[model samples]
Target: MKRRLALTAIALAVGAAASLSACSPGTASGTELVVTTFGGEWQKNFTDAVVKPFEKENNVTVKQVTLYSSDALAQLQAQKSSPQMDVVFFSGGQETVAAKDGLLAPIDPAALTNAPDLISQATAGLAGGRGPVVQITPMGLLYRTDKVSEPTSWNDPFNPDYRQHVAFTDLSNSYGTLGMLMINQARGGTIDNVTPGIDAIGQSTRAGDAIITKTSSDLQQAFAARDIWMAPYSQDYAETLRKAGQPVGFAIPKEGTTGSFITANLVAGRSNTELATKFIDYALSAGAQEKFVTGMAYSPVNTKAVVPADMQSKILAGPTLEKLVRFDPEQITGNAAAWQKQWQEQITR
Candidate 1:
């Protein structure tokens, strides 16, 4: 439900190749690649599944800085004239906003060997955007299989009997907001207009039927403890839990679930362009994709990579995949302030 942040710090000895490359003409000596990301299980998964392998393969040390996307964006904005971070990973929408604000450098897809194999939608979603934000994972819902019947629609969460048992994340979360938007759309509401869903959530909150949490870990813990019957959750979390033998399942409703792509951006005027490119390539590699799916249960954006068998039958099924609803990031970015205000007033209070 709530967007959780996960941070992983990996330290590896720099390979001679990397060291020599760093010492080259324009590169800084012994520079730490500060990669930013949300903190929690995903961070651990990333380190175990991706970072460790990359560090070993490249023989380079990486220092990770973890913070909420908004905070990172603010820091980047404040230091625009002299950027502090070398690489950043944030929500697709935030990436677009940062790109528009001139905080990111354009990525050269051709530089990545796996770039051509990436899903067309994934590339198209991030291409032509000023920022480095690209969709990293598709969004969906996570629920306790023991407590829920097979859900055919998003409206199932609104069942009167399940009232107070339904936990949801804060509305300010792009993913959570999109979940709400999906519910609205299923009920015949517009994406640009969330008033109907806001009113619905307001009524639920008033009746003490809706539980709002501030973090994804909190929501996951609540669900794991059976404190709530269902909540909109990240595909990554649901997969991780289920793999751990928890009785959880994930789905995208018939009305369609809202999804976003995540992208990494280079800080303006940074001298580590080559290193950044290598990092990106490593992150999107087939081996990395396999580890991501096997360890995190997320679908890889790389088309050539095979999805794990367990997940292929669960969250990666066709029906669930087809229900993913893509939104116009430009419009959402333009109206973010207004949306936040409405969410605070109607859902958070």
Candidate 2:
């Protein structure tokens, strides 16, 4: 009887241990992952769709911190000796800067289960010799249908008549910088060691043709108010406005629009290397990609994920998607500071 009782107690103990092990958090049982990203509606969507589901399934909680890209970069740079963030979601140029500064870990494509499903462009754009830095965003122009009779070309805002009515985010901002670069490219210029791009946009602004805002939300507000006819905008924002019954239309100009790629990178000094990789793998998974498209209205990087019919027809259709000019992060990051200096001096002045 004594032996049997002892055996039963041991069995119970073993079972409890196994149960606890199964419930351990993704980053080695008790450790929580610190994820940094842009806050607001997009963050909410990500939490609802990806973060919550991931936490439940993996038995791990994500502690998300909100910060602008520049501020986040500053924080990360400051903490290089004792990194606080486990993962970071930022623009291609920022990712390149982080990687160059040795603040990021190189991602192994072979280790990612869903890496196979990603499109060639996405993979190529993100993972170069230094490893993946960005997840690509196909960009184009957004216009108000009620005001404009025909689609405006990429260079249309450069015209004198439409100058004052054109609204764009500040060139210091990511989208604005991209828009400026695209215009420069269309005008047969380059952003590398050249101020023509900055000069042109600045001249337009000085001439009372262009309006600049700090955030995409502000740009959307202007569009909603019908204060501006058209500007370079994000597909996701344009979709959000359209869903709210706004008469906004997206177009890819004849010279081709610029595409922005954002990436989630591993922090430099985080101790949970295995867990960080797991989180990145899960985020880039096919399921997560599908959620990004369906819930957030952003295009999926995974080619295997099927985009909704309506979204595909409305946003990804025609020559627009085909003609999108993918921006080079290396070039952009190399010149970002100089561009900003020129922009302040020429355009804002």
Give the C-alpha lDDT of model 2: 0.71
Candidate 2, residue 105: lDDT:
73
lDDT, candidate 1, residue 63?
70
Candidate 2 regions exceeding 4 Å error are 1-31, 125-135, 150-152, 160-163, 317-324
Name model 1 segments beyond 4 Å from true. 1-31, 129-135, 243-245, 317-323
lDDT of 2 by residue, 1-349 (tens): 9999999999999999988764543322345778886888778877876688878888888889997777878888887776777888876457767877888877777766777766555556346323342244556688878877555576777766665668867766788888788777777787664566667777877888888777877887777774788888777777777877778887767776766666777776566667777777777776777677766666666666667776674555223343567667778777777777877898658
lDDT of each: 0.68, 0.71
TM-scores, all models, native as reference:
0.84, 0.83
Candidate 1 C-alpha error for residue 201, in Å: 1.5
Query: How much does candidate 2 score in TM-score?
Result: 0.83
Q: What would the per-residue lDDT of candidate 1 be over residues 81-106, giving only the tens digit for each residue?
A: 87767778777466677877888877
Q: Model 2 has how many clashing residue pairs?
A: 3
Q: Where is the poorest 10-residue window by lDDT in model 2?
A: 125-134
